[model samples]
Target: MITEDQLTSQEAIALEEKHGAHNYHPLPVVLSRGEGVFVWDVEGKKYYDFLSAYSAVNQGHCHPAIVDAMNKQAQTLTLTSRAFHNDILGRYEAFATDYFKFDKLLPMNTGAEAVETAIKIARKWAYEKKGVKEQDAQIIVCENNFHGRTTTIISFSNDEGARKNFGPYTPGFIKIPYDDPKALERALIENKNVAGFLVEPIQGEAGVYTPSDDFMKQAKAICEKHNVLFIADEIQTGIARTGALLAVCGNCTCEGHCERQETYSRPDILILGKALSGGAYPVSAVLADDEIMNVIQPGQHGSTFGGNPVAGAVAMAALNVVKDENLAQNARKLGELFRAKLNEYIKDSTIVNLVRGRGLLNAIVINDTEDSSTAWDICVALKENGLLAKPTHGNIIRFAPPLVMNEEQLLDCVAIITKTLGDFEK
Candidate 1:
């Protein structure tokens, strides 16, 4: 074993800086190991992981069951490249489809790839099934949505930073106001070539901005009436992260009562990623019924690593963790506790404006300009206090710890957050 003094956090960070690309602006701490809701740096300093790797660690980091499955599959078979049948892929497809209540599953490698696949399917369905003219099919998307980073995906993005140099973007996408059902209806009614409405159930990357109550259901209804597909991007909020197996499963109502009622909101096309492999492997998938998914005739859509044995096994175990441990209920319970505690702190503090989220996928709005450093400064202090979290947009900090975190651990974090925020003087 490496000695603590010899393997310091700073030394590890320096090594990364020397060799790795500067794509992410991570905290100055270097993570070496993780389990449950906690992670340790190379120097053996432990900290509560509040961001959950952008909610990808919902099943906790390096879950033993998921890891074991990956190891077993690795020793047996890793990839068959979808050329020949793999033992685990079909089983995983059935398992995932049944779990999400979909008829078919299109496995992919990353969240972006899943999003891209859904777009292709929606367009093809529009043309083949809905009789929309080729090259004229249009899909409706929300403003400020973080679908992915591909050229086509970024084309419709409202953020200049994401689109500045990437332009001449792919067309055929219609932009609409988020959280407004009326806007969606108007667009669908006005556009004869409307194909589908693609949106995030809860926009995680856009500072965890959840929409109005009845937004999703109403959107689904409109899509049905207009013969349009309602595609949900649940990459960040799916798999029990939002307290109910899926964020769309719970009522979109802002009222607290909806959490009690077991409502299963279904989307025509469901995209999932991030925690699909319990942070053990890169796995993503899009689930849909047969009619819609059948639009793609093989060779049009496939990935070399989409349904490999390793991915299949890891995904199964990761999903089992969610179902077996009742992570949905745990997240729901902890979310309530978290929001209640944060609301109490929000009463008088000028630094924190408000807290809003469905389950553990929540964010706190800092009362400052969009470019303000208050959120970043607070995060630095939180790191000093032994909790690791980061700001999303300039002034918003998302707090999503792993679902395996217990009440005692959560309270300790709450205390740390309250103290850290309390010390910041306006």
Candidate 2:
């Protein structure tokens, strides 16, 4: 019973409160339009978007190329479903497989779905190909991992809020401390039926926690030695959000590098989403070589809108933007600049304990406990200062802007962040 002309940000929030389930605690900003690295609120106030919709909009709010592809594809053909062929699916499949250097791709619609698909594929491969027993197959996942929110995916989460009432949880997932190769090694060795090691190259939702240097290389080697599939949940870290296309692409000893030797450790199974469609559409994918992917027969798995023509076109344009624009390099350079600026502020401030992250995916730890409202308060202050960011956990605010941001805009944002934190106690 509301008119469009009369709707304000407060009115919109009120409407959502009345009608929608209160699942999220969001900043009090009603954004209505976006382009490149910024969004406009309902009142026409502008702010730099820092979270990028959980790293889904790495190509920025709506890249012209991706939107154009989506629009063009919609006009010509949208969904033919996986039951039949589509003109764009094959071309897109070929493009994506080559881009990621994987032999095959299994498309899906969301990050969680892709993670689920990877789990199913790994379990099947373990039983049929690797000679593991049926229900005893185990997948090793890191602590503080945030894959997605499906029932099965949430089953393995260590976060109390994410897993509290969502059970009886799924089983067969073994947990190990993240960034510790020794823990993963012991888990794999002690458990003879280990089927896969599922990990995030860089933990995103866990306040952008990054792993140790040489951890990925050592873990990959262990998985290979044990004949277990190395499943990387790159839903948040992939597609150039981190420098070099993946967070697992640099050297840990290089001060600010990614530290993962790409040549030494290529994951057997890769799960991707978020930025896969440049935030233009929902597109997720699981990738593996044919030997592993072919284990599932035709009837074993499928989704109706998984590889539709529109998704195919959108994903293609998104991936192309990542490469064509060199967003990976841009993110890396900008990340260094951002961290430097933040760290400079951290030197004198008692409000922030630390700043950690790579590329554009970063987080600042508030000088408060997990139950503190400081992070939320700081985010509100940031909104007032013309920037938008959100807290992950209670005292941890994540700041992952789109890779399309420029240096001047980034510095402007840094100034806003510093000034806001400066005025927190005043």
Q: Taking the candidates one at a time, how many backbone clashes does each contain? A: 0, 4
lDDT of each: 0.88, 0.88
Position 342, candidate 1: lDDT: 96
Over 245-341, each residue of candidate 2 has an lDDT whose tens digit, in order, gives 7666642212122325453367899899999999999999999999999997888899999999999999999988888888888898999999999
**lDDT tens readout by residue for model 1, 96-187:** 88777789999999999999999999999999999999999999999999988999999989888788987788999999999999999899
Off by over 4 Å in 1: 1-7, 251-263
Worst 10-residue lDDT window, candidate 1: 251-260
